[model samples]
Target chain A: MNNFDVTVIGGGPAGLAAAIKACDEGARVLLIEREERLGGMLKQCIHDGFGLSRFGERLAGPEYVERFMDKLSEKTVDVRLLTFVTRIEKTAEGFCVVTVSRDGLERISTKTIVLATGCRERTAKQVFIHGTRPAGVFTAGTAQHFTNRLGVMPTKKCVILGSGDIGLIMARRLTLEGAKVLGVYEINPTPSGLTRNIHQCLHDYDIPLYLSHTVTRVFGADRLEAVEICEVDESYKPIESTKVRVDCDALIVSVGLIPENELAESVGVELDSHTKGPVCDCQLMTSVDGIFSCGNALHVNDLVDFVSASGELAGLSAAHYAKKAQCKVNIKIGNEFLYLVPQQLDLNADNSRVTFYFRSKAVREKSLLRLTVDGQEVFKRVYPFLRPPEMQQLVLNMDKFAVQNGSDVRFSIEVAE
Target chain B: MKSFNCIGCPKGCLLCVEEENGEFTVTGNTCENGKRFAISEMTEPKRTICSTVKTVFEDAPVLPVKVSSDIPKDRIFDVMREINAVLLDKRIDRGDTVIENVLGLGVDVISTSDILNRK
Candidate 1:
């Protein structure tokens, strides 16, 4: 069996960054990808707007990942493309990762494993769009692949359901390609995408964004012909009185993204109810020791920059991880937050430099985010606005918090009265 | 007077531009980039266009390309048209210039990905 200090599954940005960081830390690393290419979904994301935080430049998705891929190619880490890890068994001596590739089945043992298996887009079935399975119905990612990668026009006239980032981007992309985008419909009262995307993609393009509206059902036999748009109430209950019919040839859905955690679940890693990713400590190690998770596999991050940051953390931690009793301090947050990453803190480790990624539960104006340890305020920042679609990140120095194994850590957001 | 929300960062600060005596004053910016973005929004807006160029490779039908620098906002469609018309006949890696000094503009239409040469 091949052996390495760190084995990263999925060669996306997270895995690439993780493998590279581990290798840089003097750990023998192996990166395995299921696709022929190292880039994950970034390959098909041709639009610019990435790397604003990391590189301080507006780079395209491919370009953003190309930077990481280039650095990784120069490293000593072993990269295996078109290789899929089938099963992972926790043995007494680290973890045994079984794989299936062109050469057939093989096994590799690694001291620590980083699950960077990214996320998958939610399909129409998950959103409960009732209709005959038509040819024109496509997910936002599929449409992007057809347009950006294959150079094929997936639709002529389309109605997008969900104002998610992909849907908003596709609305502009399709419009730029001479397609007719009727309008973007969202069940939520507010837009689901970033405000900047709304300004540039939809508003700049003259495309309409209809809030509190959704596609209840679609019509068509051979291809999509029409869709039933209904207005939803505060509780998302469909108001039958406000049902309207819109004619469109295609229905593109970008409901949401779900973290791929079946592999983590198979290995008995605890999952968080809010983020749907593994319950990880400040070190990014999951409830199962020696197994870490990062990137979208940990939580669906709005920005790819944060994904790379989390991967770096997980990789650096995995490389330095030793079999020792972890003293973890639980972190609690109020209902003001949708979720927070690094659910717990490793008291035994250096908790001084912790990168926290979080999002408010609702749209908040003039809000203050306070981090308190042992009932003492350590850090607090007031933001002008906070939206669920935009994630906020902070690199905090926890040294002054004087945290201990039994210390209570809490985070909360208070809106200005 | 005009207003814009700076997309330069996640802060998304609302920037208001007021013109008095042919001079512009930007306010409500959380950072220096916001002021610059506000000035650009009031004057000439520039944006970078990223799209795919047709390729001869069958395995990879299109190669992703982008302008090396931002162009005038009004010239986005012109850049896209020039990008769409070019059909790459030779294998080119990332950073290879697809069209040098495109349309007399300072930026070059360069390949942003190496997918065409991978196969």
Candidate 2:
């Protein structure tokens, strides 16, 4: 029965930052990781284009995470590796986390908990890709693990089923590793990856990207041999007449990522239908008091910088957590936004310098995002263009809005006339 | 006019470049980096690639490495060949060069991770 002031789960970039920040705030912190090593997905993401905002340099994923690992080494935080959290129970004092590791079952009590459990990729079965169970089908993240971490090539000639950023990067990675990436087939008309990734990873390597096309079926029993591709309509239904079979050894799926929240759900945390994560407050605290959510557990963030920023905030808030009544007000949004983080605001706590992350529902030119309180515009910002793939972040003085517990705090986006 | 997205930053501003007798005029750039990127794309394009190399240690099978600077885009596979040929047996720290003056491009391939040295 170990006791701690704060316990940070998952040793990814988010959890690492949270542990460091909590330790810096003079709180006794403990970090638990299920893997043999830390760094999480960053270890497999051995590509550049990370740390541009935080470090002001284009660093590889290992390099970006190593900086945080170095900072965490100087702090006095207890780290447990190869440990898996089985359950989290709410206690009268705070929380009791049950974990199983090489040493066996152990329960730790903490005043507050920060959930930094990252997201998981949508698999082939999850996306409704009907196919024979084959050996060559893998998610983009799985393929990345095989190549970057394990040094094993997962495909020889493969067809990618989605245009997500990881899939785009893999197209170039496999090419550099002497594998032939036939083409990337995205079900949507618009590419799902960042514009820069489409250029640097695909265009630079002469990898073709076919939009509005999807792999409806995969053929192979022992190993993946070929795949059935078809042109999809606006409703994403396959147009039967447009079906074509292509020979390939593998199918890499990069459809989407879903936030891992089973532990949060076990603790009775309410989730937002849009973001598919815990409905959090301005401080990144979940609906369940004393339990904070950040990083991909809060929402699927496109950039790691925002993930670390949210983790730092959650860590600081959890470090100062006390049992008290909360005054919460829901934050409403218009139909123009795909989703927004921090679905609610706590009037009882500090509201100054609250950060919001959001994405537009569609591509729009000359758009304006407005924040209104009680039908009066409190803040507004103009953008030249907004895309769904790129999430936006903004920091505002929320205390200036004079929002009460029952006040209407709404965020809306409108295309400029 | 040739239009393309700038890889300068995540903003991904759409840059339009026009060529007029060896002089290029670039528009729609938010910063000077985008302008320079467009100019380089029109001429000799260069890119930085980060990849892993095989190592002798069983604990860490591969070590991550990257070019010290941007190399010519066409020489990527050529550089990969040189990187693949190396079978590193020493524990090198980050910024330690794996290959010096690789392919005479005046850039060294350096290790980007110090995983072997981590205790």
Candidate 3:
């Protein structure tokens, strides 16, 4: 049996960040990762566009993770690679984390816990694509990990479904690996990925992007031989005569990503159906006291940088909880948005500046993002464009709107289109 | 009728162009960018080629590389031939300039994938 002041699960950006923050607060933290390496998905993501705020430098995923890992080593933080935590049970005092590694089954007790299991890619089975059971089909992330990370292309002639970030990234990846990408089909009229990715990956490669289109059927008995694509109406229903057949050996699907919250659910934490993550206030804590969560495990983040930032909040909260800290007030979500973090309010807590993370329902062009409390607008900003691909983060100083008038302070983002 | 689709955006606007005896006419576009797109698609097809060449880099057997120019769609094979013929020496790090001013297209092929040292 092992024990620590703080215990963090899943050694991705969130876990690593939380562990580092806890250690920074002079807390003995036990960090566990199920993977053989410290870096999580960041390891396989060899692309840049990470670490703009945290490091003030744009870096690839691995490089961003290396920074925190180096700090963790300097702080002498204990991390167990390939250590899997199977169960977490809350006791009268704190919680017990049961884990199993190559050594054997082990249990650890901690004052506070943070879950950062991250997310997994949505597959063909989840989306229900009409296709034959073929060998050449794969998820875009799986294919990327295989070829880009493992040096093995899944197939030669490929047709990608979903113009998601992963799908777009793989279109460029597979094309470079001596494979012919027939086309990328998206059911939506607009791509579900970042704009820059579409230009740099698909347009640059001349890989046809069929928007408002979908793969109606997948042909081939044993291996993927071809695909039938058809255009869809505004209602997302397929048009009859718009069918086009493309011969391809493989099909890659990047439908979307969903948070891994089996552990979160097992702990009886309240989940938001929109984000498919835990519903909390602004502190990033879960419904269960002393148990916090962040990263893709909380919500599927479009950027790794945001995930790290979110993790920092979870880490800070965990440290405070270990020391038995409390906050007098809590901020709740308002409207046109889903939810906030840190479900409880601590009146005695001194942290004034608060960062609110949220997501929008649809894409908005040229709108004002406003924050209000009890029908009074406190903070507002105008933007040219707002996208769901990018999570919206707003930093508000409670000192700016600190008041004794309202007992319930609601903080939600409203679009003034 | 000059009804062409703008492959520029996911919107995929169906632009119509009417040429009365070699003159120019256009319609069916939502934005001005789509206007430029229709003119270009009807006149010439353009695309940017992003692919990696042979690399002697350390860790990564394959490095991410992209073309510098939006080459004419027909010149894809030609540009690819030029790219395939070259050998990129090892020690090329991520974001390193692999090929500069490729094909006078004012674009340079860059390394997007990282190669790490074993030590």
Predicted model with the maximum DockQ: 2
True contacts kept of each: 0.60, 0.65, 0.06
Model 2: clashing residue pairs? none
Taking the candidates in order, what DockQ does each have? 0.67, 0.81, 0.10
List the candidate 3 regions with Cα displacement exceeding 4 Å: A323-335, A338-348, A399-417, B1-119
Better of 2 and 3 by lDDT: 2
Give the interface RMSD of candidate 3.
6.4
Determine which window of 10 residues in candidate 2 chain A has minimal summed lDDT: A122-131
Local accuracy of candidate 3 as per-residue lDDT tens digits, A138-177: 9998888777566567989999999989899889867756
lDDT (10s digit) by residue, model 1, range A53-125: 7888878888899889989978999999899999999998899999999999999999999999999999998
Instruction: Write one digit per residue (lDDT tens) for candidate 2, span A25-124.
Output: 9999999999998998998888898888998999998899889999999999999999999999988889999999999999999999999999999889
- Summing lDDT over every window of 10 consecutive residues in candidate 3 chain A, give the lowest-scoring window: A338-347
Query: Tens digits of per-residue lDDT for model 1 on B6-115?
Result: 77765667789999987889998978888888888778888777788898889889998889987888888888889888999999998899999999989999998888
Give model 3's docking category: incorrect
In candidate 1, stretches whose alpha carbon ends up further than 4 angstroms from where it belongs are none
Candidate 3 accuracy as lDDT: 0.74
What lDDT does each candidate get?
0.90, 0.93, 0.74
